[model samples]
Target: MKYNLIFGGIRNQDGYEENTEEVLRSFLSEEMEIPNVGDIQFQNVHRLGERSDGKERSIIARFTRFSDHERVIRAAASKLKNKPQFSIYQQYPREINERRKKLIPRMKEFKRQRRHAKLVYDKLLVYGEVYNPDAHREPPPTIPGQPLPNNDGDY
Candidate 1:
């Protein structure tokens, strides 16, 4: 449900559907050496998004259980490190994706400064420093007929 394996940079060719599942099974079982992954049940295995010219569409494999999903992710993390043609990602909700997007500028800033930075959920952590968007958010607008607070220290 919340977890899925996304396969990126795999080329789509004619008759791709006929061999995709088998190919993925072989890649995980043999190449990645993930034990018993072939026995894992996939709720769905399909390409995500529209096919674009000269671009390979990503493959999304939805597992029936979260544990199975995590296993695949863990296995792929180290196995695909040197393999540029393949990559894996945890499937996040749209809201989380949007929140992560907002932190891209900060992420880049950290990278430019040569500080290791990454986004975990809605917060951005750079060199163990936390940047919480909620903490810095502007206050909500005051209701109509509510008196505004004076700035001169008067009630």
Candidate 2:
């Protein structure tokens, strides 16, 4: 599909069979305040799964156009920052999530060195550069239960 998928953080509610399209439209129009949100068309709008840990299911949406996706992401940052019951973000497959999880260690390793590391999506960047494990070589060793060293010799 040429479209990106979004997930709406839905809280618990009774009878989850409402018109998802209308709900999404109102959310974008009123909550997100995105211009011409009605112009955005969503496909496969539905809930993710049954409730778990007393948490409500999420609504999944697939819409075309990268501009619409970016607008939603930026609007979500400002609008949903204080709304716990509401959230909007792009959804990734399980494989991608797992890959990002595995990169956590590498991310920490780079940060410990004070090299300015950040993890975005499934990739890690150190000092504004993408990290390549093979080229970077194995990080310096440290004693068990000891923290890694920084630019200085101090731990």
TM-score, one value per model: 0.70, 0.67
Q: Write the per-residue lDDT of candidate 1 for residues 52-83, one digit (tens) a residue.
A: 66567888888888888878888887998888
Q: Write model 2 residue lDDT over 1-155, tens digit each, in one string.
A: 23555555654344576777677777788777788988886666777777666665777777766777777778888887888778665576788778888888988877788878887777888877887777766677778998878867577
Instruction: Tell me the number of clashing residue pairs for each predicted model.
Output: 0, 0
Using lDDT as the measure, the top candidate is 1
CA RMSD of all predictions: 6.4, 7.1
* Distance from true location, Cα of 142 in model 1, Å: 28
Candidate 1 Cα errors over 4 Å, as ranges: 13-16, 111-116, 127-129, 133-155
Maximum-TM-score candidate: 1
Worst 10 residues of 2 by lDDT: 5-14
Question: What global local distance difference test value does model 1 have?
Answer: 0.78
- Cand. 1 TM to true fold: 0.70
Clashing pairs in 2: none
